[model samples]
Target: MTIVFISDDAQALACGADAVAAAFEKAGCTVERVSSWGMFWLEPLVEIGGLGYGPVRVEDVEGILTRHAELVSASTPHPSSSATIEAWTLERQSPTVKQVQGDDLCVGSLEHHPFIARQQRHSFARAGKTRPLSLVDYTATGGWTGLDRARSMAPADVVAEVTASGLRGRGGAGFPAGIKWKTVLEAKGTTKYIVCNADEGDSATFADRMMMEGDPFHLLEGMAIAAHAVGAGEGYVYVRSEYPHAIAKLNAAIALAAEKLAPFRVEVRVGAGAYVCGEETSLLNSIEGKRAEVRAKPPLPALEGLFGCPTVVNNVLTLAAIPHIMAEGGASRYAELGMGRSKGTMPIQLAGNIKHGGLFETAFGITLNELIHDIGGGTASGRPVKAVQVGGPLGAYIHPDQFDLPFDYEAYSVADALIGHGGITVFDDSADMGAMARFAFEFCAAESCGKCTPCRIGSTRGVELIDRILGSGKTAPDSVEALPQMHNARKAGRSRDEEFQLLEDLCETMQFGSLCALGGFTPYPVRSALKHWPEDFGQAGSAQ
Candidate 1:
């Protein structure tokens, strides 16, 4: 009888082991259940004779064994039914493994795919390939190189190396990572903390999720480096609850890392599904067990955070890229890859109604058109492209006219948009620009956290005004003229004219007075829709 082992955190270890033993007993084979494979997507993944089989649903175990002839021949079943065993074998030729170097056996290895392979992968090299809980695998791939290098260097040198890389925060803000690290290192504090903001609430972004699932050790290594560099003894990863698999893997990786790496220790904290937690300060407040609300800046997390201690809060990708910067050629090597004011490879996530939905890491300066058409393969609906939302919920909606724009922070800023979290959500020709604009306000209204008046009240007003515009009939001829005049006014420059002044007033309040990006950037989608698709907001009375 063949003995198989499976490791899943959700199931008790002893229970899983007994279940496997019972399955083997029933199959007339020996059973040895160890632990779950790190890949949560393939839970109950069973390993026998160096081969992995899954997703191994509870009810299908008997049929799986019988169908694969495991009871008699001991041959492994194919990874998927769509592909034959021969095809699966061929696919595993360059299989992506995390740490231990072996024949790639998994079909989902990012190393072999063009979408993941073309650009640099300093941080994510070992993600899917390595056993997340194995420090031996992590150390084998030069995992602690950054920590070791950091232990010897002055704090300033560590900061300098990071600065040289030109690494920016992968979070929506796009701030310089090195500068933030330096601030934490320079801050006067007996106790400092390194926090990884893994609350990826953006519906269209999954780079962080993929990184955690594929290469969790890199994240650990990055966190360790930050802890060591800043002399912080403790760190926390505030992962969102939506990512149960990511949270589980990260927790396992953290426990494994703690056992293996002695000097630096990290912990994983789970967040309730609060979109506001994606904000840095809100994340900190959530970590402190408070309502997730945006705090006023000037006392950024760098200076005071998490129980009033000096904290270095960075996005998952930003920290993951650190070890690569230190190990390979330092920051300059990374900085050399991108366009002006935007350096290093950006892991752009193509989600929503796109044919190819996944992460694409490219140097800045790639055009939006290329990202949407060439890499993304256009809309999933197979219809003509209408608009794309760059960034996340708070980002702007850009029409095809803006597709020629280069994808750098400065370039996007010039076009009055911010690339928050590098999410590009494609919309086909059937998309309603007016409805999307309304959604921007609605999202802000739902997630504002009620911290500031402008965000708390203005978003609701924006939605109501949009509804008024959409609901207004011929009785309000002034409203019809006001729509065009309002669109033109925003183009001409900010104005206080009475006709369409309500929306302009709402935009101004949300832009300037809102506490965070949620409120501050609602106008991006609102104004973009008004500018690009003015016809969508034409009088409802006239339209069919």
Candidate 2:
């Protein structure tokens, strides 16, 4: 039997997948490197005789190989009951094996596993099963059906179907995907463009990376659908430089799907490592080989973008979701699943100090507590769950007390937070909220494009103010003259009041005066940190 290994998972590679594969082959086994099951902790995971095992070392493989069948079903089970585990028992449930075709390990179906069991994986159903860029495997798994559906329909029908699906941009910006599509369709340019923002710069985000590697066809088909809907003949997937594996897969997949893509051509462009480049305008500028700066809005991309013409700029998740919407009769299939207007499934990426860190695709409205405690199994540190940072680096730091909030656009907005790109990073009780707030500004300062003063200057100043506040517990600073009076009524401290209040003022200026979200959203984590953990900001005995 062939031994299967994850070929593209970054963590798996880091964990010595190549060495394991080489050892397996040297020992006279047919080694097959495959896609990941979205379980980061389990790689370089190995599947031998239909059973999966991971975090296994190259040396560990020798003993397992020596005892092949005996070790298959006898390996100790991981504590996690998630489906991604290899030591599963068929005695528990019906088996749904997608790969590693053997009868030894006895693990039941891939779908029945705990991590994947509850997920509604409309877009990513075929990720781990199929080889990347295998056109035959992609087509066999229901891949180009959406583009075929779009091919038969009129452009207006495609737009209408997407509009009715209630699909919003899966990027940090929660704009309606159909509205943007409709705008592009109606724009007065005969030559329009489609840009898929694959520059995933957020911390703890890998949905785009995995999708690009495992299911590149799905993204290409989605782009083709968008091109057909808006009457565009050219497209681009702007992948970041960090993801060289994704870039290669996307380019190869594009080549494989060339015949199906037709007159609507799709190309992969690499982006420089600027967090701000994930912003649409900066992305457009980078694509055109210009300085990656944020452009002012109003003559929007739908009207003028990607070489000063009508263009559609969408994130990888938003575009990748298009294929499913088209294949499932357009709207009702996906629209009915989510909470409120946040339609469709979110490929939530769990990272940082989490025990069961991986991708979980669920509809909107799942509580933070459920996601962190149940799915994530709390902190990897096994300590108290202190905080969860939702969205990206620019998102708010949520406290355990606020775990009651649901994962929806409107719900997060009500809490002055957002579900940006659906990245949730867990932090244990040992985490310092004060430092997190400082880093948010420091990150913005380092990544800012310098197009606007509020972001470029305010971020640097914001860091200084935080440092001053955290450094001392004395009287108020001169810049924040009003703080002493306002704070005196509530446990009065002058220096504490001055620095925090100064930080607050600086955040306000950045929020309103900044051009793009780089500046506009830097305040979210800072403000939320201060609001949730007042004591952390150099104050003594502040209550939660």
Candidate 3:
């Protein structure tokens, strides 16, 4: 009998899965360590093939192994297929066991479980099913077949398929992926590069971490396909240093895949934790061992990037989707799945104060209401659902009335919001929109690379101004107010309406004058909050 136990996943490790794996091996059974299923509440999971029994400890391993041995003592190649063990059988457990199950050998099949089955997984198809760094295991589960097929087609054809599929960058901007590829392919540079932006610093977002840890080979194949199409000889995956497990898995996957796929080598680079580095130009600067600051456009990364050469910079999920696009023989299979220009599936992260929080991938047309009410099961607090920040901290705090908004890029942009990185952070009714908006300014202030004055200075001023507005009990006046008579508004003091107008001016400066999305997008959340949750931001005539 073989016992499978979780080896990676920080939460699983903390739950003492290593001890359980050790116990199973000591009891004279073959044990394999696999990546986590990523479900937090039910972890330290032990599996007899796909049949799972979890939240178990070191002490429970021996009994489970004993039960498995009793159920199928013979050398069965697959423990899950053993008729003696049986499936779909339910039974009650003793009071001392603290749970109920058919046997210690069987809990239930994870394949049909709601947590796994509820998702329309495509890019995340083999998340918990395959080994994180094993090339052989990755291939057995339909991994590199797309690269094998991409190897035969012309570079233009691959770009054509991506363009036709309506695939866009999942790293927030929602720019067309095929268009970017075409630009890079046509750009004049012999030393072009392929870069994967894995510097994910957004709150409530861990899809990139999950992909790198659970399905590394998928990301590798995606990068390799990009390299082949662009005629690039080198690639870099700039992972965040905070993700030690992801970095280790990516390095291992790179070492193995480099051997089979020669001429195209991928190197893993770690960044100093800076949110601005998630931007492409800043990421390039970090790779060059320079200060991580946003760069000016007009020389898009496609035309002149790393080392001043043409480059293709893509998000982890965007590149991860390449294998699927190529395997399905062009974008037709994936293109039909989404709505309007926002084609194909997006891996939405259901997080923050929400029930059943995890990754849910689906087409772009799904309403936020479905994600919040149905998939998320509303707030974890059991209170009425309030606002939802669809992108990240920079995204708007969408009220419940606007819950019908679709998860499309254009749709969100039209609503004064953004679907940046596809990270959905839910908030319950108790949440204060004013506080959330203020945090956006504070985050921008702390994370600004300081290269652009609008982002660096304006963000700090915005935070200070919001504090005054909230403290002074202000609201927008009937007309724009004049600037404060003197500096240090706290001492000199302006009218509530004047301070409110000052905030609007600061937001405008950040939005129009900033060099990158870090500054340009900060106003989205700020303005949205002031517009929708006026009552929460302290009101006019309410002198505190």
| Global local distance difference test of model 1 | 0.72
lDDT of 1 by residue, 441-498 (tens): 8988888899899999998878877776665422233544467656643332222133
lDDT: worst 10-residue window of model 3: 88-97
Error of 1 at 356 (Å): 1.2
> What number of clashing residue pairs does each candidate have, in the order they appear?
16, 11, 0
> What TM-score does candidate 3 reach?
0.87
Go through the candidates in order and give each one's C-alpha lDDT: 0.72, 0.82, 0.80
Candidate RMSDs in Å, in order, are 8.2, 6.0, 5.9
Better of 2 and 3 by TM-score: 2
lDDT per residue for candidate 2 within 58-118, as digits (tens), equals 7877765654445333442322233332322232232323332333323333445567777
Residue 491 displacement in candidate 1 (angstroms): 29
**Candidate 3 Cα misplacement greater than 4 A, ranges:** 5-7, 14-16, 23-29, 57-107, 328-330, 472-491, 540-544
TM per prediction: 0.77, 0.89, 0.87
